[model samples]
Target: MTAQAVIQVFILVLILAGGILAVWLRDLLAAVIALAGASLLVSLEFYILQAPDVAIAEAGIGAALTTAIYVIALRRTRRKEKE
Candidate 1:
């Protein structure tokens, strides 16, 4: 396989790992961080695929904006108190 192909595969594997970690983590903040990492990797993959516009959108919206929103939401949530 070509170098580019190998790199793409590696990135894909990392993305999958991040996704799994996001799902498996008990901490909400950690899960958000893992998801953000996967989003960034996806943006990088788009850039490597020659889609710069999509990559930029994914980085800005998927990685940055979405992560910020999730973090803010998580911060505002309160745990239920035992009666």
Candidate 2:
């Protein structure tokens, strides 16, 4: 396989791992971070595939904006207290 193809495969593997970690993590904040990492990796894959516009949009919206929103929402929620 070509170097570019190899790089794409590597990125895909990392993205998969991040997604799994996001699902497996018990902490909500950690899961959000893992999801953001996957989003960034997807953006990188898009850039490697010669889709710079899509990559930029993914990075801005998926990685940055979405993560920020999730984090803010998580922070605003109150945890249940044991009676």
**Residue-wise C-alpha lDDT for candidate 1, range 1-83, written one tens digit per residue:** 99999999999999999999998877788889999999999999999999999999999999999999988888788422223
Give lDDT: candidate 2, residue 32.
90
- Model 2: lowest-lDDT 10 consecutive positions: 74-83
Task: Give the TM-score of each candidate.
Answer: 0.91, 0.90
Off by over 4 Å in 1: 78-83
What is residue 50's positional error in candidate 1, in angstroms?
A: 0.7
Q: Write the per-residue lDDT of candidate 2 for residues 1-83, one digit (tens) a residue.
A: 99988999999999999999998877778889999999999999999989999999999999999999998888888423223
lDDT of each: 0.92, 0.91
List where candidate 2 sits over 4 angstroms from the true fold. 78-83
